[model samples]
Target: MHCLLFLRIVSALEHRYKYFRFREDAVGKPGHTPIKKWTAAIRQLAYGGATDMFDEYLHIGKSTARECLQYFCEGIREIFGEWYLWKPNPVDCHQLIDMHGSVHGFPGMLGSIDCMYWEWKNCSDAWKGMYTTGFKGKHPTMILEAVADY
Candidate 1:
């Protein structure tokens, strides 16, 4: 029972993450058809079947399947970067104090920064250094900083 419940929770989280990532406007070019078929194909391949899923759902050849998935990912990265690239706004102390007062039982924290680690495949020697950290192994990541004012 415990294992089943854990599996359900894991699946739900995975679905939520995937939905947020792919459903965002960042996944396709402006004025272009959305990459729903390609995203679904890649998800099916990664999570379950490659050939069967591609043929049944995508109706494309294996090589085409691979190409579509690759193209979709590259396009998504480019689009997302362009859309979300912005400088952080400076923090305002008065607004922060008011926000802290309104939300009772919460710590009066002015700002917060968090880091999330991801597992990535090893890369070439030259590129590895850029992706490496003092603690984690070779994985590419971006440091995102945001400031909120109440």
Candidate 2:
């Protein structure tokens, strides 16, 4: 969520979709800005919280938050799906390997990869033993791993 990247997305979304554009209410007061709308959407997506959790802070109702989430998903899918939502072809893989070699002096590791330990609060007692790594006094955690080519 770098400011510039967020602004770039906001600009694209605001330009492509009227719902994302700022407007005035009936009383001539400005309504929600694109930033607020995107923020609500991103929070719901990134945090997986209740839709109403940040409504007060964002000055939007639960329904609006829900709407923002739905539309944000749809807009992102429509706007970025073509380039990002596809399997890598052979040519693409080769290019990625080359790019990685050039950038990091590594081979075939064309992207950032990471693993994270995520605490699983309220994990059932039966599964707790399977989830932990014998760490004393620590909650059970699951490892989340991901690879990304940015």
Best by lDDT: 2
Backbone clash pairs for candidate 1 read none
Candidate 1: deviation at residue 124, Å?
41
Separate clash counts for every candidate: 0, 0
**Per-residue lDDT over 1-150 for candidate 2, one digit per residue giving the tens place of the 0 to 100 score:** 688989988888898899999999899999889999999999998867678878568878898899889888898888888977988888888999898888778877867879888889988896677777855356898778898664
Of candidate 1, the 10-residue stretch with the lowest lDDT total is 29-38
Candidate 1 on 2-87: residue-level lDDT in tens? Answer: 76754443343334344323232465643212244444545754554454445665454666566556655554455555666654
Model 2 CA deviation exceeding 4 Å by range: 90-117, 120-150
TM-score of each: 0.30, 0.62
